[model samples]
Every structure is written in C-alpha cells, then in structure tokens.
Target chain A: MKVQVLYFAWLRERIGQGREVVETEAATVADLVAELRAREERYDLAFSDMGAIRCAVDQALAPVETPLDGVREVAFFPPMTGG
Target chain B: MSEADFDLGAEAARLEAGEETGAVVTFTGRVRGGGGLRRMVIEHYPGMTERALTEIAGEAARRWPLSGTMIYHRHGSLAPGDRIMMVATASRHREAAFAAASFLMDYLKSRAPFWKKEETDDGADWVAARDADEAALERWNE
Candidate 1:
C-alpha cells in the first residue's frame, strides 16, 4: 500500500522534507511510525518522543492505533497552537 | 490560509445581517509582544486545515442555535500585535451567540492543524501546546 505522508512544523524540520509518498505494509499508525523510524537516524530521532507527536489520518485526527486500511494520507505534527 | 488581516466590524455586520439575528459575538486573537520576540511563523496543513475548520464551524452550528458563524485564521509570518484570527457568531439571543463564539475559539485553538514557532533574540523555537488548552476543550464535550 502507498500513502502520502506529511510533516509539519518541527517534524518537517527534523525530517528535512514536508511531504513524501511511502510504500508500506503497515496496518496501523504505530506500525507506520515504526517503519519510518527504522528507515534512518533522522526519522528515529524525530519520532523518538511520540508523546509530543500527533497524527491525522486522511485529514482527521486519529489515534496511533488507528487502522490505515484504505487511508490515503497521514500527517504527523506537534500539537496544534491555533486560535 | 491568508496572511492578510481581517476586518472584525465587517464580519460582525455580515454575520448579524439576517433579520432573525438579535445578537452577535466576536472574538479576536492577537499576537502578544514581549521578551525579545521578533516574530511568529505559523505553519498549517493545507487541505486538512480547511476541512478541520469547516468541521469545527459546523459542529458549533449543530451545538447551538446560531444564525450565522464565521471563522478566519491567518498563516505564514506574523509580528507582535498582529491579529491572528477572529470568530463571529450570530444568534437569536446573546447567550447562544457568545457561547458559540467561545466554543469556536476553543476548538480552533486545539483541534485546528496549525502550529506556531516563535523567533526570538535567542533563537527560534516551536511553541509547545499547553495542557490548559487541551483541558479547555473538555468543557465543551457534554
């Protein structure tokens, strides 16, 4: 399966790019993160503190345990600070 | 995502235009200046941002008897005292209008996919989300 992955704010800074298409067999958000973290030192460091990270699946906020079946996009970022 | 400033009076006037609307409430958020802060850069997820904001505004209307609601937020570089965003709600009565506006603000503060980074004399850094902001959302959830 393939999904468009997006990074915002510090995550994008840490990852060196804002967007990418990743081919993965991950079933859930956590699994996808695990795959990403295993890819490079930068990914591992950026994802080191999942406690500070938030994920959205297909543009809607979702928990890490959220299933990625049929999901086309996933975004990772720090908690929102909008007003 | 627009970076241009929005007019509150114009928005409120438009929101309260309907004859059925008896009251209108508006809230404006501005960047605060202090402690060597040069400017703030806001980053947002493009498609998701519009979707989240629309959903939040829709939820506000569903939760309250709002005659109309408007939410406008800015992205990109902003300086101290710049108007960051504004929310206006019109209703048959003041209570609903006020509550809905507050509700819109609370949700926008947390649920909206926007992040703020502060550029200061020392350096630039991402602003951490406050626990209070998360706690503020709970009050709206039944």
Candidate 2:
C-alpha cells in the first residue's frame, strides 16, 4: 500500500523534506518506522528518539502501535505548541 | 498560512449579535517580546489543522450553552507583540461563556496541529510543549 507521509517542525528539517509517498507492506506504524529507519542515515537520525515524536494516522492522533489497515496518510511531528 | 491580523472587535460584535447573548468572552494571545527574540514562525498540517480546530470548537459548543463561538489563528511569520490567535464565546450567562472560551484555548494549545519556532539573535529553535499546558486539559475531562 502507498501512504502519504508528512513531517513537520524539526522533524521536517532533520528529514530534509515535508512530505513523501511511501510504498510499504508494514501493518503497524512502528513497523513502518522501522522500515524507514533502515533506509538511510537521515531517517535513522530523525526517528532515533521516538519519545519526542507524535504520530497522526489519517489526520487523527494515533499510537505508534496503530495498524495501518486502510490508512492513507500519516504525519509525524514534535508535540504541538499552539495557542 | 496567513500573516494578516485578525479583527477582534468585529468578531466580538458578531458573537454578541444574538439577543440571548448576555455574555461574550474573548481571549487573544500575543507573541511575547524578550530574550533578544527576532521573530516566530508557525507551521501546521493544512488539512488536519482545519479539522482539529473545527472539532474543538464544536466540542466546546456541545459542552456548554454557547450562543455562538469563533476561533481565529494566524500562521507564518510573526513578530513580537503581534496577535497570534483569538477565541470568542457567547452564552446566556457569563459562566458558560468564560468556561467555553477557556476550554477552547486549552484544546487549541495542545490538540491543534500547529507548531511554533522561536528565532532569536543566537539561533532558532522549536518551542517545547509545556507540561502545564497538557495538565490544563485534565480539568475539562469528565
């Protein structure tokens, strides 16, 4: 399945791109993260500290363990700092 | 992302238009100037941001007897002292108006997809989410 993946804030800066489409067979977000981390040094570094990252599947906040059965979009970013 | 300033007076007037609007509460947040700050830049997920903000406003209306509600947030480059965002809630009584406005603010602070970065004389850094902001939501949970 192909999913539109988004990065924001420092994550986008570190990853060098704000958006990308990835074709993956990973069932869960964690699995997908692992696959991306293995791609290059940049992905590995960007995703190194999961504690500082947040994920939203299909525009709704979700856990990293969430399964991507029919998900079309996923976003990763640092915690929001809006007001 | 909009760099335009929001019209607070107009928004307040709109909220208070209805006859039942006995009270209207408005909250505006401005960028603080200090520590040699140069500017602030806000980034947000386009599609998710609209959805989140709408959901939050709807939730506030459902939780209280609000006659009307308005939420306006600005993105892109912003200077210190610029109005970043505003919320207005109208109700039959002051209590409901106040509570709904506070609820909207708390939810917007953490739940919205917007991220802010502070650019200073030394360097630029993404603003960290405060523990207090997360804890503010706890009081609203039933």
Highest TM-score scorer = 2
lDDT (C-alpha) at residue B25 in model 2: 96
lDDT (Cα, tens digit) per residue for candidate 1, span A1-83: 99999999999999999999999999999999999999999999999999999999999999999999999999999999999
True contacts kept of each: 0.98, 0.90
Write one digit per residue (lDDT tens) for candidate 2, span B1-142. Answer: 2568988999799987868789999999999999999999989899999899999999998999999998999999999999999999999999999999999999999999999999999999999999999999999986
Candidate by candidate, in order, the iRMS in Å equals 0.5, 0.4
Total clashes for model 2: 0
Model 1, residue B25: displacement in angstroms?
Answer: 0.6
**Over 4 Å off, model 1:** none
- The candidate 2 chain B region of ten consecutive residues with least summed lDDT is B1-10
- Clashes per candidate (backbone, < 3 Å): 0, 0
TM-score of 1: 0.97
